[model samples]
Target chain A: MKIKLVFVSLVSFVAIAFLIYQWWPSPERAIKNRLGGLAKTLSVPANDGDLGRVTRVAELRHYFAQDVRVRAGASGPEITSRDALLGLIGAWTPPPGGWTIEFVDVQVTLGQQATSARVYLTAKVSGHDARTSEPTLDAREANFSMAKQDGDWVVTSVEAAETLQRPGSQD
Target chain B: MKRLLFGSNARLSLLRAAVLVVTAVVVFGYVLLPVRLQGISMLPTYRDGMLNFANRAALWWREPARGDVVAIRMAGPRVLYVKRIVGLPRERVEIAMGVVIVDSVPLIEPTVVYKAPWNLPAFTLGDDEYLVIGDNRVMAMENHDFGRATRDRIVGKMLF
Candidate 1:
């Protein structure tokens, strides 16, 4: 009887363990998917007042409880929600120049507060410029922070890394 | 024979440990975790990081009443937001500056607050929309889309 009881309990335990392990990470993934989808809506080319929405979007990250920080490769003024839109305005006046950029990899960690995501990607630039005669290539790793307001997710800030100079190209 | 008995016991113990860990994670990850994660934002009554219960089942028994605080899901596909219920669906909501008058009666705002800049009108709310604004109007609270939190998105009310 004693041996039979032990065997029964062990089998039951294994069954329970298998069930929980399979569904455990769902809520976290749900939150991430929600935040990411909302972010995609705001990822259009920065335009007039669009930056304000971006600021509010950035503020969403704070709900996840992380601070926002940003690092950029191009030598330009820091982009704010308003600035992002204004930058486009400035870019469009004479259409200064256009560049192609994509985040290589972005990992967003969703939690109560202090939410942060790391983004990796490359940018291809090609246009008439006083800076960089040819198409300059730059890669970066950026960390984004998320937060909450009322009861929604916001991107409070971002921190991006600076890329080093090419092997032989330092004038 | 002795080795067989010991080996089986050890395997059983390992299985038990695995079960305990998994059970803890489910209870912690789903039910307990969301409760603790839900919190009061920017209000003195509910301090920052204070965990609050959500009464989603309440809606099943009765219609959501006026002045009850609710956790609403915003339009951003996957966003979960909380706010005080100021207007019922289809009720005409009017706002001037930061104050709200629903059916011409002043609705009591939540202890935690915000006001959107854009005058949140009844039209802005698509059929299932609920107009909820924060009490603190400092952060462009008086003019923004945060007010038009939809009803279908509401998870439940905040349990104080």
Candidate 2:
């Protein structure tokens, strides 16, 4: 009876330990969850008027630090400052046919210090221009550096990593 | 007399199970990892839906050489990309008309399946930095995403 009790106890302990490891909240999961929400917020259609769009853009600014440095494309100049980044977005005219944006393949890695994270993701934007009504399709790969500020993750910097060709499109 | 801790049959079975588990962990964890290709940027070398093995053991002792196909570690393992390393550290790379110019010399890339007019100004690479590009260069300069990948970004060599 004593040996049987020890055996049962060992099995129960192993099972409980496994359950804890599986359900524990990890740093990678935390970063991924934050970035996932950010992606959804960024992909929201900005077809509303400049004022409405600006409000949406303002929602984006809250995800970033006050002094955020952003480079939109590989050849684009780096804009430093939250206002400047928003200004660049505000300058854009909404598409006449509406726009569809998607962020996919999001991968996040926590920094060694545990206070920073690096994210790599792909963004696809397709729509028609408001002025000329020309169809526009843009796909890009970007890397974002995020920092933890007061228990909230905020974007510190963004770099345009690569420009991907739309799949199945002939070069 | 020799006696097994467990019965002879059970001991042999447990030994076989342990060996199998160890082999699987070593092979899948560090030696060879399977990945699915997502895009046609690699073209004739790797198809869009083909399965390939990432040879992590390739870079264990040595750095990757130019023209070697490699997988890069992006934000995480799930978003890694496969590309060929072209420019090594300290080398200036420029694309003129469809050819790659390295330090004023034309770089010989035999695996390039297509060549499109890609004009990029010369940029010197920093230490521990590498220029990675796809084999399908026929894609327009604007469409293809080729850029610098630092040492830590590279995950391992790709085996087709």
lDDT against the true structure, per candidate, is 0.48, 0.76
Give the poorly placed runs of model 2, Cα more than 4 Å off: A1-14, A25-171, B1-11
Model 2 interface Cα RMSD in Å:
9.2
Q: Give the Å shift of residue A164 in candidate 1.
A: 41
Report how far off residue B145 is in candidate 2 (Å): 1.1
TM-score of each: 0.40, 0.61
Cα lDDT tens digits, model 1, B95-153, are 65656767767556655355444344433334665666434455563232245545565
Writing each residue's lDDT as its tens digit, candidate 2 over B1-160 gives 2445445665476568768999999998777878777677898788766899788889999998999999886544545678998889899888899898999999888888688888887888878788888999887777776788788878789976
Query: Candidate 1, DockQ to 2 decimals?
Result: 0.01
Q: For all the predictions, what are the DockQ values?
A: 0.01, 0.10
| Positional deviation of residue B118's Cα in model 2 after best superposition, in angstroms | 2.2
Taking the tens digit of each residue's C-alpha lDDT, what string does model 1 give over A1-171?
787788789889988999887667653444455555644443333232545444655544433333233335334355455345333433442213434344333454546543433322222222333364343332334455555455555555555532222111221
RMSD of candidates 1 onward, in order: 18.4, 8.7
